[model samples]
Target chain A: MGLIQREIERAGIATIGISIVREFTEKVQPPRTVFLRWPFGHPLGEPGNSAQQRAVVLEALRALYQIEEPGTIIDLPFRWRREKYADYLPPTAADLE
Target chain B: MDVTRFKNRTLARLATRFPRLAQRFIDGYQAQESAGSIPWAVPKPLRQAKLALVTTSGIHHQRQAPFDMNDSDGDPSYRTLNGEELFDDFQITHDYYDHTDARKDPNIIFPLGPLRELVSEGLLGRLAQTHYAFMGHIDGRHIPTLVEKTAREVAAKLKADQVDLVLLTPA
Candidate 1:
């Protein structure tokens, strides 16, 4: 969350945040941000996909070094395979509300 | 009609329709009654002492556009809290109500008002000049990257200002 990162940063420690949605974070305006195009809840991917999750987390940690200024955003280059999971049903708008 | 039977029938129907919801309700209820009996990691005192609050409620200045609720379906990665000014006219637009409402109170989500109170009482060193917020249901791939980048930048500024602890409140 932007607030957690902000708090950590405010405490004189370095922080970074990865987000799936850009609009809300854009408002909070943390120093550095990365956007990924994936469904909600499972930020790193399916629960068992440790390999993919670790890779994504490592990439996010790496972004901290690349960003030098506040309000910088980058879109990661990754895609989720539809065939990877047959039970994958992303939440719908009605379900969310 | 027996009252016990009526209650049991109602609960059975509810569970059939929303099994996860029913489970969560039972879990939370039991957790509350048990109080501190469950084992979980207790957070250490923040070495970096500057404190901040985070909310998933997609709260923003009324002037700003709200987070895209339509983006993620059932398992929304992001969570929103209707706290601060953003919740003055807040509305739910997602199905994952448990995460969103787990600690639904505004004071719990956005503790700025209380932080200021602490400052007045000298309970804390000081509140960060600014706080942060986000939409909770973010996809994981993007979160690590975006959160890290923003945190690093914000940390630099906070360090420059001599802040020491950060209190993270996730909704």
Candidate 2:
């Protein structure tokens, strides 16, 4: 989607991406980007968790206004608590098969 | 371990073993679960709870317009999952949708089956009459209007049906 953002930017629309992974997105280097250390499937954060979603969304929206130069990336200060990661693990091949 | 080092090592391993699969898994997991649930000092009572699933799988009826792939490749906002029933013969088109290797399984993406299970178990209050799908790649150009329109229409329909939560599932 970063590519789309760049297109939009090329079309004269300012764009910002709220990416979970900084490394990959940094490579694309959109005009403005925000990296949050969040899990996949839930960009704005867990189902039914609106506040976090709103904050993340708002922050991304804010980046559109705050950043002046192209290719700006900012790492959000937020981190998930350790306990949350305890029961959570990426799926394995066995589960997929 | 420090967070940076931990994420770097984990991502590096995924990148080496399963680059495409790893991207999908990490994108899904990190986008939502990485930070845990965002805390709300005072959580608002859900205004509209009739739930639905929106994905980025570029799923659409063969007759409907396909999501713009070019847009998906560039902008994050152009991707949306179409909200149509899965065809019995439907097959995944992208390697990124692989969930089999995930520890939690890929049911997290299309939880419709699980949601049905939950419904049978009486875990949810009620299911919306319909769910939604959208490709994950969207460019955000004119998307605010589109999303608002979609959300409003969906919410209205779900509210009419008395749905209390919209479970957004990104594939």
Candidate 3:
């Protein structure tokens, strides 16, 4: 959670948050943020794709190094290649009723 | 083109086997979003900073205490994972997010592999001896306790370990 990140940063330790949902991360405004277009459960690419996962992590750390201003967010160019079913589905709007 | 998708913690595997449970998950998820505090602290360069990793992926070793899944509000607890431990020894107890891939390769949730590489390459300062993990489904209210208390404790541990930078991954 970005809240936790902020608390840790407040303690004088810098924090880099890698997360989904750009809007949530935007609201939290972590000192440094790396936004990924991946699904809910997987932040560093798919489950076993080590190369892609490492790339995502490296990008996050890279952002950590490059971001100088407070609340800087770097959107990762990576995409979740497979179908994401866990915790993500649109109910066609009418389903809420 | 006029669909509505919400941020949910999980669509249980049961949701697929039972189908009808998906809506409940959505309701639970939307209720979890919150307004987080903004705090900023600048640190030294990455190559000079002592690094640590924190994850909301519910990761823990079999020997450590497990997160309580029964708590609907969230476990609000934390675990310390030695960076040296084998990835095979760890397990995830979270139900909110899909763990299928995480079960196979932990980099999906905790990127210790890349972290180690970074440290060795001298791109990142040395790794902190410790790391942390907790379940990510806590509601907005229960979260402050985690942030104010548990996380502070963890940060203290990081401070004790002389860590300067933390990479937090949220699922």
Candidate 4:
């Protein structure tokens, strides 16, 4: 996934990846990433959990704008099936800027 | 199914159910590490950027041919996804992971629904009508093909679509 992401970023499109395997992400080194210690096939979060999914989307987008140095991977703090996401405040336009 | 396919599927289910087993599997595959400079693209503000998804989670339209699971080197080819109608007939092809949860709710891997909701709430700008999907287990001989051919092809397509930001998810 990081390999493909590198190509997309090289094409001048900003890229951020959600990585399940930290070892691969660290090796392939995409432009920006959010590393989650979640299970395989569950990069965003649990099935049918909209709030957790949205929180992840928000974090990736936030990392997209916030990460300046290339190849930076932010370790997300959400625990699989053990964390609550109802209070993940969506960043406003001003906050992003 | 052949012996290799059946083994891969069974192991995938085990890996998904057990992270330690997944780690052992991940450890066996030596992912190529970068040696030189990394590519960087300046990002625009989320509220004004046109976002697109690129998932290596083996998702494709049900009508489309599934990714080739026979190749142990893994399939480097990607499928073009139409955001509007993808969920109506979605299918997952890669045998590298247990997709029972993703099948129940694709947003766990694809996150398109959550992204659309963000757009609706005015937190995100707009989503590109098109996205991409690839089977993530490419290895050995297919690595060069992915780096030099198929991945570049998807990148060019994303460029043509004027996508400003991309979020990649893996299986």
True contacts kept of each: 0.07, 0.03, 0.64, 0.94
**Lowest lDDT 10-mer window, candidate 4 chain A?**
A88-97
Residue range A1-97, candidate 3, lDDT tens digits: 7767877888888788997767677666778998876565678877666667666766676666577787888886565575333423322212111
Tens digit of lDDT per residue, candidate 2, span A14-72?
Answer: 33456655665655554567776655443444444334443454354344445555577
Best-performing candidate as measured by DockQ = 4
DockQ order, best first, reads 4, 3, 2, 1
- Compute the interface RMSD for each candidate structure: 16.2, 13.4, 8.4, 0.9
| Fraction of native Cα-Cα interface contacts (under 8 Å, chains A and B) also present in model 3 | 0.64
Error in Å for residue B16 of model 4: 0.8
Residue B17 shift from truth in candidate 2, angstroms:
5.3
Evaluated on chain A only, model 4 obtains a TM-score of 0.94
Off by over 4 Å in 4: none
Worst window of 10 by summed lDDT in candidate 1 chain B: B30-39
DockQ-derived CAPRI band for the predicted complex in model 3:
acceptable
What is the lDDT, from 0 to 100, of the residue B48 in candidate 2?
Answer: 19
Residue B95 of model 4: what lDDT? 94
TM-score of chain B of 2: 0.51
Higher-scoring candidate on TM-score, 2 or 3: 3
Which window of ten consecutive residues has the lowest lDDT sum in model 3 chain B?
Answer: B1-10
In order, the first chain's TM-score in every candidate is 0.76, 0.76, 0.80, 0.94
Q: Can you tell me the DockQ of model 3?
A: 0.30
Model 3: pairs clashing at backbone N, Cα or C within 3 Å: A87-B11, B9-B96, B10-B96
What is the per-residue lDDT of model 1 for residues B1-171, given as tens digits with 9 covering 90 to 100?
Answer: 356435633553454345454554434331101112211111122221344444453444555554554443212233322334544654433233332321243442344544454456444444565454555445534445444564455545545755544433333
The sequence of per-residue lDDT tens digits that candidate 4 reaches over residues A4-96 is 999999999998899989999899888899999999999988999999998898888888888889889999889888986776677677766
